[model samples]
Target: MNSVQEGRVALVTGAGSGIGAAVARKLAAQGAQVVRADITATDGGVVVDVADPRQVDELVAGLGRLDVVVHAAGVDDPRAKQRIADALEAGRPPEVTASLDAEAWRRVMSVNLDGTFHVLRAAVRAMVPRRAGTIVVVGSSSAFDAPAGYPHYAASKAGVHALAQAVAKEVIPFGVRINVVAPGPTDTGMAARTPAVLRQAFAGLPYATPEQIADVAVFLAGEESANVAGAVVLANGGRFTV
Candidate 1:
């Protein structure tokens, strides 16, 4: 019912839960006709594995015209998460750098980096002809500094940031703009699963809600941020300045 994003169509990936779900709802509230895609479709959006190029291509092709594309779908398996959480504990056993779970790292990269690549490629395919669109990628602040425990997660996110910056130039001539939103520890289901000890390290920064991050995402997707492209707007709620 809002006129802010009326007539603007948007596609939100990983819309089943977490930040992706929040972004989809925010776009809808702003009056955008939002199409959602996720492995588990919670809001009646199509089920999609963003890592699959075929599925990503079909989803965007079906939309015909897209004003916004939000790629929020990413993965960090339970083992990897727990491994990082253990690091928060005092006197935790030291892990050999070479003994880490390589398979888990691959899964993280495939979903986080490959998934992002698939979505961006498909969005460009659909938007270039129209010569207009905004692509907003949900990146991670960890990418700014790949910590010891979560090396894979950090690398994958860094790849996404680099990809967006590189792709932003290619899409410039066609009138398409791409940007990234890197958020710090957000109070979502994912963050809640982590121990408080780990989160307390950044006590100086206020915890951000899903809605707060969505506000920044909506701004980047709309005309309000026309001059902002190829920029990584860190939404860490003052936790870190980068």
Candidate 2:
């Protein structure tokens, strides 16, 4: 019997590592033709920085038949993340909002928020005409429960949730479904570098693996989630009941 994704064409950004890589591999294993994209050429993936709208548009436009699109490319400046982590560990508050580093904030917004918009816009344009497609955005649990030290990351994800919701409505009538999978901290390279003290904060809390999150994303992208649309599925390891 043919699998649900057999012969389907899918695009996954940030396919170089972590959740994005996992999503790409799962889709391929399920028999989908997965196009891997990332800011770097890791794994010989297409090199396109989501932060650039032109690159995102071109990448989507070039995909002849896009049955599914998972926008998973995202970043957090490790230096800034660690600096705030360190301050919080020492019982000192990180800089106030007014004094937050402007560049760092802009960098996160550009890639997380603006980049999401660019990818969604381009994907919708391609999917609407065909009147059949699904989109799964990798979001952050921080958007629901604010983070202690990373306002930029939290804010960007919150914006992503809203954007996906708004756009989902507009596209559902055209047979395209858009949803978000917001996961808590997973065992990714980005999380591995987090300060020990910070990791300790969630020591006993539920932590997830990249594959686990990928399972959720793939589920939402396929027929199983056909009735699901414009929803944010939180895979945050029992952190919050909501």
Candidate 3:
């Protein structure tokens, strides 16, 4: 892909670590003026929680002119998986769904699904007036293949894909291009915490580096994806068939 021109304003959420950080640095290297954000990031970006619609709105408003938006902020707390694993270890009947905590379920849905909605909502509003923009939502393979213990995570991701698809249709006609990058189990800290039994579902699949996914995000965020909208591009190493 050609180098993204300098001075292009870009905002990347969850930029404190993982794929979000990688994408922020990548866009910077490509000469775009990036606004890196997270709950806590040392890169001078103000703390912003994607789950809060007000925070998302204010962040976009501060940018003024948004050329690109990459929403990577989402939660994958390990405690729920650990709890299910513990229950199985303690000889309790493996009630996979019952083992998940109600609070955790709500929290995951809020941050993963609702959070994506808030970011996209704000981004669409910002991009619509300009009549040109690119949005790459970092989703997950969990939407298609739910693991044994992470029902909430899986469900939330599914919702993200649906929301992105729906929003893309509404905004594409207005020159706002929105797409999703649903990566498989990449070599992220969250993947490391998955229990063996649950992770077995993704066995034989090679993990991808955060930077690799960042590369894909950079592609979708640039003019290269001009004709692409409401698309879900998988960056997995041949793990999923579709």
In model 2, the Cα lDDT at residue 238 comes to 88
User: Top model by TM-score, which number?
Assistant: 2
Ranking of predictions according to TM-score: 2, 1, 3
Clashes of each: 0, 0, 0
Q: In candidate 2, what are the lDDT values of residues 1-242, reduced to their tens digit? A: 98789999999998999999999999999999999999989775799989899998888888888999999999876766677787886789876465568898999999999999999999999999999999999999989888766788899999999999999999999999999999998999889888877788788886699999999999999999999999999998888856
Off by over 4 Å in 2: 96-98
**Model 1 vs. true fold: TM:** 0.93
Local accuracy of candidate 3 as per-residue lDDT tens digits, 18-124: 89999999999999988988987556787998888999899899888999999998888678777667766786744567656688888999899999999999998
Q: Between candidates 2 and 3, name the one with more favorable TM-score.
A: 2
Query: Residue 194 error for model 3, in Å?
Result: 3.2
TM-score of 3: 0.92
lDDT of each: 0.85, 0.91, 0.86
CA RMSD of all predictions: 1.8, 1.2, 2.3
Question: How well does each candidate superpose onto the true structure, as a TM-score?
Answer: 0.93, 0.96, 0.92
Supply the TM-score for candidate 2: 0.96
Give the alpha carbon lDDT tens digit for every residue of 199-222 in model 1: 776678777888888888889999
